[model samples]
Target: MLIPAHFEDLPFDPQRPRAPRRQLRLESEGSTASGETARVLIHNISTTGLLIESAVTLAQDERIELALPEVGNTAAHVVWMSESFYGCRFETPLPASALGTLELFSRVISKAAPSESADTLPVRIARLRKEQGLTLEALAALVNVSKPTVWAWEQGKTRPTPERIAALAKLLGVNEDELLSGRDGNALAQALNQARQVVAEAFGVDPARVKVSIEL
Candidate 1:
């Protein structure tokens, strides 16, 4: 889980440490003044700015509007660029609540199955549904999907979208991590590596320069 930390006190001071940021993988859409919308992959986010990758060409200082979930359209300007990746500064910093929502959405979107899971994702979803005393129809209603869709998910014929996964995890009273990766400890190492890579790319530095330490 991501803790919402304030970034109001921190400015863009090169002499001081950067504001706290969270690594995430969120698929969202953005539009430029040309009214062309493109899919964007959000790599990480902070109150002040974010790192994103897209196939669409964006020049430095170019303004774009992102269709962020729950937060609606957010305006930002490109601050730097590296190949397909772009570092952007938000026109207005996100609030703590908005940051929390984005973090939750990111977790739901970026989950990967553990390599040695005892059960497959479909089996785990079915088991969790049963454990929650929910029928197929009941779960479908709760997740705002059709019964056939829920059945398909359980049958492994189809997978839920990231938004639906978030809703399903909440309805089943499970963390997104637990639902997707079975809460494997190895996931922590993977998460750290991903974080380091995101930070390194955002700053245009070597990944080795970005060290992550956990207090607990």
Candidate 2:
């Protein structure tokens, strides 16, 4: 051990179990131990562990589930926390080759899903617009509304009238109730559950394995 001063810069360690750890920055949806769902930004991840940054406060040893890229719904326990930053160790370690690679994930979702309903109008509209490859401005122009108005609809800020709802539903190829069903989280759990099935089909995965939270 005393004869290795010149090898200090070498990033490899023969004593370590595997290859060096790599880093990735990605976004995901996580459910807290308290059953609250929030958006989380994954700062870095490896087969054994990951670091997450979120607005939600987490406690030490709290159990949480993260919908990770490539990997599916992975259960982890919070090993450490400091305000909005937390560290975790996966309940079951992933394959060494599976970590730090969202570029591959991007390829997997390159083909958009077909028109389908979602848990809320905002989610439905957002999903439809993405499927049709339309941006906010484009959708707004086609709908004869301001960009903010379209955004408002996507955020559940305001629900359109029945006539407007009909037009939107027709435009998105979804039923009106899919858009109006949950004005604001009114029994959206059921709708989101159904939407997960559609998402699974769209991505050619099993419904139970769809961990990305079926977003808009």
Candidate 3:
């Protein structure tokens, strides 16, 4: 086994509480069968499963291999995906011991239960704009852009450039990260899974049945 030479031992702090459960953003950058490098964000993951949101579409039951920096590598089955995102369940469980090494590189690592909020950039922009009490026209005036541009931002059909993001942050009195990336990929996956269960229960069927037949 190759031990990461950079991992350092820190005195455990009881009060710190194992940090929050580190959330991982799954990213895929490889050529698909059609020969295009598909980039995707891995929304959520456990030892047994992973939720991915990618630009490329994957059919259910399609088998694919994944390159994980932490867990070495593995294969997965496409359990679900939309035009822009997909969820996958691993074919096998990752070794528990690997979690420790993974924590070192993860963006969000802690012990808390994974949050289940569904975050989308457009929804976040709309919510923050409303919270700040900035009218679309007012925001447009502040950004020196047209009102229609602001509308497109809220609708999520397009993304603002770095300069536009800076302007939006200035108008909303928030940071760039807040204005740009409010949605947590992991949280969104949990919400999707929960919602799927609730709907399945209401309809008196297994969740798997619903997924197999549901049209993307």
Candidate 4:
């Protein structure tokens, strides 16, 4: 469970210290663009703008819709984009009901530091490997890949192929889509891949497997 990170403390005065922006892992389920649902994580949020770290890539000015649990789907526009992180400004402010729910969730998160046990790519891969009782060597053999390849995935040094992810899903008893696309899919994944290429140089691994959202 990857918990979203939020700021601590709400100020009594309206101008007092507002809650720090929260980092949210959000899923955009259905929209006109993506026939299927999409998952995304919002790294930071403020009244004016939102910084999202998505597994997919989005074009500038792309129309995006987000589904907040209590808020339902809301519309936004992509104002900024890097390789992995994109910024969106809400087209219309959310309803009071939805804002209330978000406030409540933020308060709860503010009281506690983010739990490390929450969602992480490495943890996901480790759990999958453990559940399948497939040693790194075993999985490597199954995939007709080198042991280092399997090791890379486990260590967050690489990511596996969608094909391999499909196979691994069956072995680990998890959804193929979840494995192939940890949170973001479609365009988001494309953007994430581009970001990984730059970051991979420091890590000496393929951006595909060791992708921050998707495990190698």
Q: Which candidate is the best by TM-score?
A: 1
Candidate 2 lDDT, 1-216, residue by residue in tens: 000000011245576435332222232222234343444555456778776656566667765655545676666778987545568898899877665454344333234422235465678788778887889898878777766567657755456667777877677766676666644353576787788888998999888887644446
Compare candidates 1 and 3 on lDDT and give the better one.
1
The best-first sequence of candidates by TM-score reads 1, 3, 4, 2
Per-model TM-score, in order, reads 0.36, 0.31, 0.35, 0.33
List the candidate 2 regions with Cα displacement exceeding 4 Å.
1-37, 103-216
lDDT of each: 0.67, 0.59, 0.58, 0.58
Specify the poorest-scoring 10-residue window by lDDT in model 4.
1-10
Worst 10 residues of 3 by lDDT: 1-10
For candidate 4, write residues 60-148 as lDDT tens digits: 87655555667565667789775556778987776656554555544543434433475555567676787778888888787777765
lDDT of 1 by residue, 1-216 (tens): 211111111224464343222222233222223333344556578888887656667777866665555777677888988655678999998776777777665555344423235577777788899999999999988887777668667756468888988888888777777778766546777999999999999999999999998885
Model 3 TM-score on a 0 to 1 scale: 0.35
> Which of the two candidates, 2 or 3, achieves a greater lDDT against the reference?
2
| Candidate 3 backbone clash number | 10
Q: What is the lDDT of residue 187 in candidate 4?
A: 61
lDDT of 1 at 104: 67
CA error at residue 140 for candidate 2, angstroms: 48
- The list of candidate 3 runs beyond 4 A from truth reads 1-37, 108-216
